[model samples]
Target: MKFDKDAWLLEAIRIKYIIPREDGTVWRRKWISADLKSMSREVHLIKQRTHKATQRVYFNLTFKGITKSVLVNRVIALAFLPNPLKLPQVNHIDGDKSHNYLKQPTPELVEKWGEYQLEWSTGRDNEKHAHANGLKTGRGSQNSNAKLTAPQVVEIRASAESPSAIAKQYGVARSTIVNILEGKTWIHV
Candidate 1:
């Protein structure tokens, strides 16, 4: 549970059994053991011969006094190896804690849960939050809007020969008359 400053990971392996493969090679089944003497009780179970509960032989560590216990398999010891990273918890580097090896660190399994602290704290996805800041309100805006009422536009059209001429004669911008003539933006016809 706590691999503290004083604590160290001890490498002790125990062979469960061996199975002969089709290629005439024997595969050794081994596990890791504890470094601390306090875990001696569980360590004894590793070498002891016990009765079979099911089909497979279960060679497990019996942590009598110590609350924390680890695998007593050699290959598993090789899997995690001499030391591990300062992780929030014990993680299987290769998705399998049984495959703990020094060179093969569990980078994928160990995620930075606190990396996006803000996201978790706010309870909102980053994309959902509109991170926009618009420009400040207008400053010094005169009668910039060429908002001429329909009646006003009609009068201008009637007084002048052409839309452009009407715009010029009525002191309105030429584009405004052209817009009215072409029935663009704001004007229906």
Candidate 2:
């Protein structure tokens, strides 16, 4: 049988992260830096332990005790070896890939998979939306948009136009203008 070297390196790297301690202990990790560079599963290189050595690497996964290497090109792989077989895609529910629990899956594996992963801008979602939208990129959203910003009021009044016109130009909602003009949110002009 031949051994795959590249595969061995990858499994070794991931094992350092996912595999439980040899003492049968589990540890929690913050986040796994995504692998931006991945190659074809079949792209195996013959890594000689020495110029003429025969030892090589083969990437494989094992849920419990069953170990075998499978060639498939993917950023992530799942192995369902123990009882109660599962689909082969692991989910980091909390966006923490090191929390490899076959337990409660998250929305990343559910409803909002990629749509909610957009980067956050002002009025955009951030950490607050992390649970509902795993692997989020943007800052959390403000709870509501009922109030006007102080700069918004100044832009409305100190300008040579009506609040409605300025509101349209600024892309802010219209009611925000009323709040600014009424001094309910920011100091009115």
Candidate 3:
């Protein structure tokens, strides 16, 4: 199966931030279809590498006159995978964002790497999968910006102080205190 260019174009049109052309098409549609004959061709030629911040495999591809970073997994999924449910997010099953290919050591590679899997997933399911795989770190005391320790979380749970007072004492928001009190966060502890 081929990438559904029309579906992508229509989705792009739904974004309010995109500036529309005089012909009623958005900027994304104009450039995405301008010179690109097939997505597969562009995807194959581009050098695949991992983004440092995102850990996702991507490559820069020039469309019309604009060069943009294209995600390898999304391209491969759109081109080859079936998404009957039209799920919005693409998940790397093994928690390795750089692992996007379905087959090991594609024709482009001489050395064999194990097959990487991908699936169409909803936003919530994608997050659950990431947490399950330890890919995400924004939960509990593992969060880099977390102010409270596990002991503090326990103390907060046991405190009878008003939420505002507890928040003030801990230098955090009242909502944080409330969430802790209600057991909305810091679940593992």
TM-score of each: 0.21, 0.21, 0.51
Error of 2 at 62 (Å): 19
Full-model lDDT, candidate 2: 0.39
Per-model C-alpha lDDT, please? Answer: 0.34, 0.39, 0.63
Report the lDDT of model 2 for residue 62.
Answer: 40
> Candidate 1 residues 27-63, lDDT tens each?
3334224433322222121332223442212233322
* Model 2 CA lDDT for position 127: 30
What are the per-residue Cα lDDT tens digits for candidate 3 across 1-189? 976543553343343213233211222222234434422212223356777887877655444454466666776665556789989888877676766665444543324323446778999888777765677777877898798988899899888899999999999999999988887887656
Superior candidate under lDDT, 1 versus 3 = 3
What digit string (tens of lDDT, one per residue) describes model 2 on residues 39-62? 233322222121123122123444
Clashes of 3: 0
lDDT against true structure, model 3: 0.63
Per-residue lDDT, model 1, residue 120, is 15
